[model samples]
Target: MQIWIFSYLHFLWALNKSMIIEWTHKRKNSHYISMIR
Candidate 1:
């Protein structure tokens, strides 16, 4: 859960730079699960 929150925060930061790199593996998986929850 913490990891998902962390990445989401990072996603906000990446918007300033450009965009997040394609999330694969646990990164993307956790994001989707968190969203559903």
Candidate 2:
């Protein structure tokens, strides 16, 4: 039971980390496009 909970938490943390990276990348791309104009 403890191992299962630990794995679940780890999975959630990895998912959140990837999401944050993706969000930041999108934001940067948009900002770069606006600056070009």
Which candidate tops TM-score?
Answer: 2
**Candidate 1 Cα outliers beyond 4 Å, as residue runs:** 19-37
Candidate 2 residue lDDT tens string, 1-37: 9999999999999999999999999999999999999
Score candidate 2 by TM-score against the native. 0.97
Question: Which ranges in model 2 have alpha carbons more than 4 Å from their true place?
Answer: none
Candidate no. 1 TM-score: 0.41
Q: lDDT tens string, model 1, 1-37? A: 9999999999888875553354355588898999999
Scored against the true structure, residue 18 in model 1 reaches a CA lDDT of 57
Poorest 10 consecutive residues of model 2 by lDDT?
1-10
Please report, in order, the local distance difference test score of every candidate based on alpha carbons. 0.77, 1.00
In model 1, the Cα lDDT at residue 17 comes to: 53
lDDT of 2 at 10: 100
Task: Give the per-residue Cα lDDT of candidate 2 at 23.
Answer: 100
